[model samples]
Target: MTADDRRVARYAAAAIALSVAEAALPSPLPGIKPGLANIIVLVVLARHGWRDAAWVSLLRVLAGSLAIGQFLAPGFFLALAGAVCSLAVLALAQALPVRWFGPVTASVLAAFAHIGGQILLARAWLVPHDGVFYLLPLFATAALVFGTINGLIAARLLALPQGKATS
Candidate 1:
């Protein structure tokens, strides 16, 4: 494989590992997750670019679902939708000035987009009722809290010495 391919694979592996680990945890809320794997995507976006970050994110969702035996399930679709929306938002956010809007802003926005996409998909396919919208506040709040934490972690990782393999 090419160097770039290897790097993407490594990043995706890391993300998948985190995803699997998160899956092992018992969440108090059904759809609420720490989304720690996203920190890898944010770091990849900052260091490599949006395309590489997208690869990492997509690969994580696919491989992670398979690893957790959730492929083609409702959880898989939710994850896929979230990744798509997160990547789209990250692409748009990349156009902003890096000086003012950096990894933290990108991470937070992407997190919200991810959750929003999942909610929409759930409402359309999983729940098929207006009642699903009632969970928006809880999901939104979780997104904000987890997104900020993930963003801070990504920003710190980005700020680390260049010797690390993340770049």
Candidate 2:
């Protein structure tokens, strides 16, 4: 395969791997997910571009939802909303000076926006009960924690030589 083709394959593989990792994480909350795969997304965004990362994020959610048997459920909608919001954030971030903040900061903000959008969408379309409000703190905490970790991972990964990453 060509160099570009190899890079695309590697990126796609990382995205899928991360998605599976995220999906396998145990969740006590019904609507909350750890978003571990976002680490790979940030890496892809930094290394490749927002457009490529967007495609990876979208494919990860759709294929992941199907594999996890949530394709037909409202969770699919939540994932879609989160992915779109994340992509929008990444696109905007790309327009900004990279000197202001690193991948971790961007990842944190994107995570916050992602969860916020998903929650709003869910409340508006799927769950009308106010009980869902109780999960805000939990969701926020997860986003902060996971986003930080994902950002750190991305930062560390970006520091490594590209050839060393797959080793």
Candidate 3:
């Protein structure tokens, strides 16, 4: 396989792994996750570009769901929706000047979009009540906290020494 293909595979695997790992963690609320897999997506976005990032992100949702036995279920749809929304936000985020906008900004925006997508989906089909909106502040806070942390992690990875090995 080509180098980019290999890189995409590697990144996607890592993202899927993270997704599965996080799935085992206990969350006080349903549908609230740190989205740790997004760190890989941000890294791919920087090391490669948005397209590769999309592949990694989508693969994580698809493969991770299957691995967790949630494929084609409600959880799968929620994850797919979140990933799609986050990717759309990231696409537009790339247009911003790099000097001002970087991984952290992109992460925060994408995180918010991720949770926003989930909330909207939950409101529309799952819950179908205005009551779902009541959780906005909580989810938003989680997004901010997790997004910033994941972005910082990606930034650190981007700064690592290239002498380790060739891509």
The TM-score leader among the candidates is 1
- List the candidate numbers ranked by TM-score, top first: 1, 3, 2
Please, what are the lDDT tens digits per residue for candidate 1 over residues 1-167? 88899999999999999999999999988889999999999999988999999999999999999999999998999999999999999999999998898778998899899999999999899999999889999999999999999999999988889665645
* Winner on TM-score (1 vs 2): 1
Winner by lDDT: 1
Candidate 1 ranges with C-alpha deviation above 4 Å: none
Error of 3 at 128 (Å): 1.1
Per-residue lDDT of 121-158 in model 3, one digit per residue for the tens?
Answer: 98999998999999999999999999999999988888
Of candidate 2, the 10-residue stretch with the lowest lDDT total is 1-10
Clash count, candidate 2? 0
RMSD of each: 0.9, 2.4, 1.3
Give the Å error, residue 41, model 3.
0.2
TM-scores for candidates 1 onward, in order: 0.97, 0.87, 0.95
Local accuracy of candidate 2 as per-residue lDDT tens digits, 1-167: 66655665677667777777777777898656667778878888888888778767887878778778889688888989988987888788787778988998879988988888888888888888777777889898888988888899899989988775443
On a 0 to 100 scale, what is the lDDT of residue 154 in model 3?
84
Candidate 2 to truth, TM: 0.87
